[model samples]
Each structure stands twice: as C-alpha cells, then as structure tokens.
Target: MIAWIRFAVSAVLIVTGLVSFAAGVIGNCRFGYVMNRVHAGGIGDTQGLFFIVLGLAFGEGSFMDILKLALLIVFMWNTSPVSSHFLSQVEYYTNPNLYEHMERK
Candidate 1:
C-alpha cells in the first residue's frame, strides 16, 4: 500500500542519514583530536558532538520521529564541517602551525 511505501522510504532515509551523520562525527572525533592533540579544541568539542547526540536521541521512537531525526542529522552533517572550518580558521590564525604536521601545504 501507499502507507507502507511511505514508511519504507522514511525508514531508509532515517537509517542512511544516521549512518552518514555517525561517520562524520566519529571521523571528526578521531582525526580532530589527533590534529589538535595537545590542545582541547576542535569540532568534536562543540556542536559536532552535540548534534550527533541530539540526532541519536531525536531519532528514537516512531517513523515520524525518525524523519525529524534524519533531517537534523543531515543538517548537522552538512553544517558540522563548515562550522569546523571556521573553528579551525580561528585556531589556525592564532597559531599558524596548529596542524603543521598534517598540513598538505
């Protein structure tokens, strides 16, 4: 039925969204720390972790709930990097070699 199809589509979106969101969070956590090992500042420290937690928490329960969760996760996943970039720019400007070892150029 149409309802079942809708439900299936929503579920797929939610799962894929969560998976992508999780991967970004974990990646940023791991490498972000390594990039700033001595310091205690990175995307993982700010909205990144918060978004992931919120997404997971919000994703629970019914299909509608998961849809909202998926949307939040997608939004966070898209914006986290941009936020991180700004944060990094702030940190890098203050210390030009903040990530010297990892810097490509």
Candidate 2:
C-alpha cells in the first residue's frame, strides 16, 4: 500500500541521516579532520527533510497539507545545496592544507 511505501521511505531517510551523522562524527574524531563534512551535513538535511515529508504523507493530513509538505521538501532540497556550496567555499578558502592535496603545476 501507499502508506507502507511512505513509511518505508521515511525509515530509509531516517537511517540515512543517522548514518551520515555518525560518519561525520567518526571522521572528525578519528582524523581530526572535516573531510566530506559538508556532504554529510547535506545528506542529513536531505534525509531528515524527506523523512518528515513522508511522515506527513502517511498522517491524516489534508490535500493542502500534503501540498505544503511537498513544497517544503522542494524548498529544503534547493536550499540545502546552496548552503552546502557556501560552506564548502568557506572551508576551502580558510583551510589551505585541504588545497595542498590538490594537484598543481
């Protein structure tokens, strides 16, 4: 059923978010580095947002509520990337050691 599908999707999103958070924490603690932190953060946002929207879909919500939830999901998806890009730019600029790994002439 559709409800089952929504529940499954929500579960998957929540698991993905948890895994990403764990990876971020482990990477920071083990290496004292923030490699892929932005990616992990974005994954957290995306998975968390989708999980919420899917939960709403499974709830006793009206058509308008579902529409609003969809809009929120779309907005989150759009803004998450922009925010990640800005964060990455800041990190890249502030951390010269990161760029030292880059191949250069």
Candidate 3:
C-alpha cells in the first residue's frame, strides 16, 4: 500500500513538472519581449526541473539519491535566479529603447 501511494505521488509530481516545462517552452515562443522569454524559460528550468528531481527522489526512496537530488535542486535554485538576473541586466544595459516604453513623470 505504501509503495503504491509513493508511486502515485511520484508520478503526479513528474507529470506536473513536465507540464510546467511545456508551458515554459510555449511561453518562450509566444512572448515577444526578450525579458519575458527569459522569465518564461527560467520558470521552467527551475520549477520544472525541481519537481522532476523531487519526483525522482521520491521514487528512489534512498538517502543518497535524495541527498544528491537535493544538492542538484539547491544548485539550480541558486544559479537560475542569478542567471536570469544577469540576462535582464544585459538587456537593460544594451537595449536603449527599453526606456521608450516607460512614461516620464
């Protein structure tokens, strides 16, 4: 019974992660703005990968596997934001027209 429950939960989590990834892909193609595309892809890369790794950890049900997965998640959790922020900074510094969209007081 416990095994079956674990399997079910793991399956659901993996599916949800896949859906998030799909949404990110779709969003990247759908959005016109550079920042928007980066945000969309970053959401999928971080959240989707986290969920997938989490599901895999649950399925493995071993301390070592879980530890490794946790490390991977932690690494990604830290890096993804920094990367997205860097990209945004690059766009802001390079794209002179960015301010055109803003209203002056």
Ten contiguous residues with the weakest lDDT in model 2: 26-35
TM-score of 3: 0.90
Candidate 1 lDDT over residue span 1-105, tens digit each: 866665565566556545655655666566643445313333343344454545454435467766776676677667756666776667667865666666575
lDDT, residue 42, model 2: 70
Which regions of candidate 3 deviate over 4 angstroms? 100-105
Order the numbered candidates by TM-score, best leading.
3, 2, 1
The best candidate by TM-score is 3
lDDT on C-alpha atoms for all candidate structures: 0.55, 0.69, 0.90
Flag the better candidate by lDDT, 1 or 2. Answer: 2
lDDT (tens digit, per residue) of candidate 3 on 1-105: 999999998999999999999999999999878888888999888989988998898899999999999999989889988999999999999998997644454
Tell me the TM-score of each prediction against the true structure: 0.48, 0.61, 0.90
Residue 11 Cα positional deviation in candidate 2, in Å, after optimal superposition: 6.9
Instruction: Give me the candidate number with maximum lDDT.
Output: 3
For model 2, residues 3-104, the per-residue Cα lDDT tens digits are 777667766666665676566555545553354666666765777567656665666357888898899889999998899898878888888688665545
Please give the RMSD to the true structure for each candidate, in Å: 7.2, 4.4, 2.7
Error of 1 at 18 (Å): 0.6
Identify the superior model by TM-score, candidate 1 or candidate 3: 3
